[model samples]
Target: MAALEPERAKLDTTIPNESRIADYFLGGKDNFAADRAAAEHALTIAPELPALSREGRRFLRRAVRFLAGEAGIRQFVDIGCGLPTQGNVHEIAHSVAPDARVVYVDHDPMTVVHGQALLQDNERTVVIEADARDPAALLTHPGLTSVIDLDRPVAILLFAVLHCVPDDDLATHIVTHLRKAIAPGSYLALSHPVSDLCPEKTAKLAAVYQAQGTITGGRRGNLRTKAEVERFFDGLDLVEPGVVYTPLWRPGEETPHRPDATWVVGGVGRKPRRPREHPALT
Candidate 1:
């Protein structure tokens, strides 16, 4: 049988897309041959890639639920949102708050195209093609503001996406930029792969991604330690159980176990109502 066309989206199926690779990791069938190859290549080194990806998704679900239900947030902006799959940010948020609005942003054209098609009928949500590195542009997009009100408390989600920004300075700038742009009481929830638990494995995994391309796109490893990853949340007030292993962040029912099981670390930070000058969350 021949390979099927990428629906109507003009996607370069030849090159491995980060979203497609993540889709493959999440056991989805929307990936191309290139994505499977890249994923298989990484699997040889880190067999836990799939598990790590699923754990990261779990963290996203938990965080979004918290923001919508417990945190009383009504607007959500999910940057670097990959392929639209089950239990997306909008779905999770809507479950808790029917009136909650969500804006899903992804630089990948394929993701944007596919998400737009999938969400065309969902009035409360909209997906836009935008780069996460430029938070100001995306945050200010009419498409985002159409659904999200930046004036009030909105949750900005960066789940399993920041590691793609290998440049330390640029990564910090992105977070800081977003922190500055959002109004007071807004929240930033992020989950990043950490190297503190398994330095050797994580480094090799980073090299695998670094070899693949400029953006080491993966949620399992990025060669940064817990401390380094924590810098992204600087200045903002971290919520309870700040920056811990994914499973330990807010695990349901079951007792959280080994940190190595979930090498990825996650946390949710909020901007105070009266910042002593509105510092950047660098």
Candidate 2:
């Protein structure tokens, strides 16, 4: 394990972090009072928050399994990896390919600590403390580079985290940088909250998150539309059934799409083997 920087080791229990609050929503006890308070408040707005969390996690597991089992992607760079939970990216990927490598990135100190503990014995996994806003910093981090091979196909997992990024241009830039760093045939699996599912409820919930000082609230941290979310996959080949609700994205069981249950939208896309040529080209 790499040595933790003093700055990254500090844990502030006063302010509620989105990752801890999310853990609270998922029924995890590794959270502070601030986290639970914020989660409770958010729940008042969107009553289905807990369900959304569970479904999002399930979507992550299924997506990772698909990437590893079917896509044959053995390396994963899971950005904004929330509190260490069961069946994480590495756990799912390694289950299919023991040699699979994963680098978990998050700005939360608790997340890093918990993730490090959970992945202690797993030599193929490494947890790095870094802000998701800076893809270059994460991509070039010593811990990540040690395990993840940029030259090979890597699955960039951006599950339920992009909303934390407030700036649209910055968010797009980060994705672009990461996509550019990876080789052809790499994959990107992402899930994000959408306001369109339950506009009223989501709007109210955004207020709760804002009051708690969570990253996304107000104009900065609200949910995005389906078309806006699709922009993240620019220049990539979306997998079949692209950009749909979590439950409907290649569901494991015979579950029908619930257009109303719109907390999250998720999909997988593959980087093409060759760059698209301009129409004016020969």
RMSD of each: 5.6, 4.5
User: What lDDT does candidate 2 reach at residue 69?
Assistant: 92
**Tens-digit lDDT string for candidate 1 (1-282):** 112122322467877777889999998988888889999988998898888888788889889999999999999999889998878999999999999998999887889988999999999999997777666788888999888878888898999888877667667778888887778899999998878777887788787776765253223345778898888787789999999998988888745646667789999999888765645632
lDDT of 2 by residue, 1-282 (tens): 112233532577877888898888887889998888788877777788788888888889889989999999999999989998777788788889888999999888889999999888989999999876667888889999999889989999999988766467777777788777778899999999987767777667666666666663224535677788898888889998999888888886746445467568999989888846512111
The alpha-carbon deviation from the true structure for residue 167 of candidate 1, after best TM-score superposition, in angstroms, is: 0.4
List the global CA lDDT of all models: 0.82, 0.80
Question: Candidate 1: what lDDT?
Answer: 0.82
- Model 2: colliding residue pairs: 216-221, 217-221
TM-score of each model, paired residue for residue: 0.91, 0.91
Sequence-dependent TM-score of model 2: 0.91
- Estimate candidate 2's alpha-carbon lDDT, on a 0 to 1 scale: 0.80
Q: State candidate 1's TM-score.
A: 0.91
